[model samples]
Target: MSIYLCISGIVFSVYLIANLWAMSSNRLNQPGYVLTDLDGLVGVRHNSLSRLFSGFTTLVAKQHIRRIQVSSECLTLFTDADDCVNIWLSDRYLPINANYAKVLFPQAEFVDSPFLP
Candidate 1:
């Protein structure tokens, strides 16, 4: 496994420890993740995959590595019902993001996403 996977695992594990174990405060007040701001999400298409991957890694680390009151993780950074998503990528690896997207949709239309948001 890569260091990124290790880092993510550590983060969720710690969250389980503090929350499920009741060793810490309410998770809503001390979220393990954060929502990246609109600025961070805007024009996210880096010139290279390595750059995009590295940037995402940094963002995740910055968000989950800390224990804060306001987690961007609680925020929904994007609602692209009116946008055209042109992901010009050669490979795919969104880690836990697929779960988020799948949970957000339930057999939704693909060709014409009238409710993409």
Candidate 2:
């Protein structure tokens, strides 16, 4: 019916607008750090939505990071015994390679968080 068509058109328009905004904003350009036992990865790009909500709090030191934890949704870098830097990841913007991380931190823990980007 005309009513259904109208609704579908509105939904499509909204989806298109949101996708364009995300692309234009380059939503994964925030600086992040990756840590491993033998080597450290720094200056990685993080999700823009995560940075916007969490803000930058801790500065990770390459020498201090002890472990790296990766999950489907996020990457957590631990340092100084207890400190952690949580970086959210998006499928559209994967700044780091998960396979490379796995090779670097073979014994690292993987956890799932109840958050989405």
Q: What is the TM-score of each candidate against the true structure?
A: 0.20, 0.41
Question: Could you tally the backbone clashes for each prediction?
Answer: 4, 0
Superposed by TM-score, candidate 2 places the C-alpha of residue 87 at a distance from the truth, in angstroms, of 0.4
Candidate 2: tens digits of C-alpha lDDT, residues 26-92: 4333222322232454443344433343453334445555676655556776765887766555544
Which one wins on lDDT? 2
Q: After superposition, how far is residue 49 of candidate 2 from its true place, in Å?
A: 4.8
Reference-based lDDT, each prediction: 0.29, 0.50
Cα deviation of 95, candidate 1, in Å: 5.5
Sequence-dependent TM-score of model 1: 0.20
Alpha-carbon RMSD of each model: 15.3, 9.2
